[model samples]
Target: MRGVVMHAPGDVRTEELEMPVILEPTDAIIRVTATCICGSDLWPYRGAEAIRAGGQRMGHEYIGVVESVGGEVARIRPGDHVVGSFVASDNTCEICAAGYQSRCVHQVMMGSVGTQAQYARIPLADGTLVVTPGELPADLIPSLLAASDVLGTGWFAAVAAEAGPGKTVAVVGDGAVGLLGVLAAKQLGAERVIAMSRHADRQALARRFGATDIVTERGEEGAARIKELTGGLGAHSTIEAVGTQESMEQAIRATRAGGHVGFVGVSHDVALDGAEVFFSSVHLHGGPAPVRRFLPELVDLIFQRRIDPGAVFDLTLSIEDAAEGYRAMDERRATKVLLTTD
Candidate 1:
């Protein structure tokens, strides 16, 4: 099998690797059909996050066919086409039962397992894998793959922000997740969606995703613009899809009093001012999205062709060319990159 390995910052390679097998009763193995690069992966690639001693495996989002399942696995069987959450959870634990599978007691971070490969192991198979209605059409594969991570995360952001009918929603960040957040907000019944982006292409896509307005200004200016658009009261809900000091602050400052702010960006060196948040009078809720909680509904939406979240993948490359995909994203030439295993 071949997989992606990051030898150091700015150095990602595709190389032959060992095949995965079920090592636990809750484990299952799958032949990866599709996988992609994530914005979070850039943290290590750009040296913002430290790499392990030797190197680290990359990728967490995946959709594939089950090759085998452990003895304890039920519900998911071999030959099943499945999509799973980036974080594997038993789904039977207290936290999981409460709809926070991302923090499941027996959670396994799939990034360490590396789904960007020919085959990979999935833990908590019965709880982590969601079988599609039947065999999937090739045309729907990209969207289904998006449901495994980005789309689910974005949807979670929208839900956490309390986007609903008659409410004005603002999204901070124009990346794939942020763009999809716009879509989620609209789907959740937000009356008005504001997308903050400087890129014309992203702005266009944001509009296509139901963004009624675009604000190019960032940071404080961007927050001010959001408030201005909402008649100085700010948005009823704000989605913070970028995890940074500026983005976080902007999101909080852009929401009206008693509003909600859903933040899903992988936080990196973000420090919040106590006084600012104390006076903001907004509800803040978000973390690594509990994607497992929404997989079924999202998959249904994809099957119905109700949402084309896959449009975010403007660039596609063979798995062997993943390095270029990373470069394209880092250079702002692509909104999202899909790495086809086939």
Candidate 2:
């Protein structure tokens, strides 16, 4: 099988690799139908995160057909079309029962397994994989794939931010996740959605996704703009989809007192001021999104064609061109890139 490997920062290649098999009783193997590059992948690609001694496998988001299942797997069976969370969890743990599957006791980080390939192994199959209602049309595949991670993460951000009817929500990033966060906020009944973005294209898409306003300014200015838009009280809720010192601070500062801030961006070197947060009076709740908790609902939404989260993937490439997909994202030429295994 061929898979994507990162030899070093800025060096991604498609290489022939050994096929994965069901190594655990709960494991399942799938023939990857589609996978995509993630913003988090750029951390290692840009040298912000250190790579291991050996080449690192890339990608976590995937949707595929089950090739085989281990003896313990029950709900998921071979030949099932499935989508799974980026973090594989037993789904039966106490933490998972509490709806935090991302931190499941027996969690497996799928990034280490690399779904950007022809085939891959999925741990905790019965708990991690969600089978679609039936065979899906080709057009719905991209949206279903998005549900595996970005859509679920964005939805989680919106939920954590407490977005609901009559709430004024502000999103602090314009990436795919951020853009989808806008969609999630609107879907969750936010009366007004403000998208902070400098890019015209992203702003247009944000509007299409239900962003009632756009703020091009970033950092303090962005926060000030958000406050100004809300008559100096700030937004009722804020979603921080970019994990940065500036973005995080902006999100906190842009939210009103007693509001909520749901941060889902992979934190890099972010540091917070104790005094500021202490005074902000905002509820902060977010981490690796428990995508598994929302997979079933999101998959149903995709199956019903209620949301087109796949619009974020402006670029698509064959798996062999995975390097170019990475480059396009790094260069800001594409909002998101989808890599096809076929």
Estimate, for each residue in 1-342, the C-alpha lDDT of model 2 and write its tens digit: 999999999999999999998899999999999999999999999999988778999999999999999999999989999999999999998999999999999999999899999999999999999999888689998898898889999999999999999999999999999999999999999999999999999999999989999899999999999999999999999999999999999999999999999999988889899999999999999999999999998888888888999999999999999999999999999989999998
Clashing pairs in 1: none
Q: Encode model 1's per-residue lDDT on 1-342: one tens digit a residue.
A: 988999998999999998998899889999999999999999999999988778788999999999999999978999999999999999999999999999999999999899988899999999999999999899898899999899999999999999999999999999999999999999999999999999999999999999999999999999999999999999999999999999999999999999999999999999989999999999999999999999999999999999999989999899999899889988889988998898
Distance (Å) between predicted and true CA of 311, model 1? Answer: 0.5
Off by over 4 Å in 2: none
| TM-score on alpha carbons, each prediction | 0.99, 0.99
lDDT of each: 0.94, 0.94
Report how far residue 328 has shifted in candidate 1, in Å: 0.9
Q: What is the alpha-carbon lDDT for the whole of candidate 2?
A: 0.94
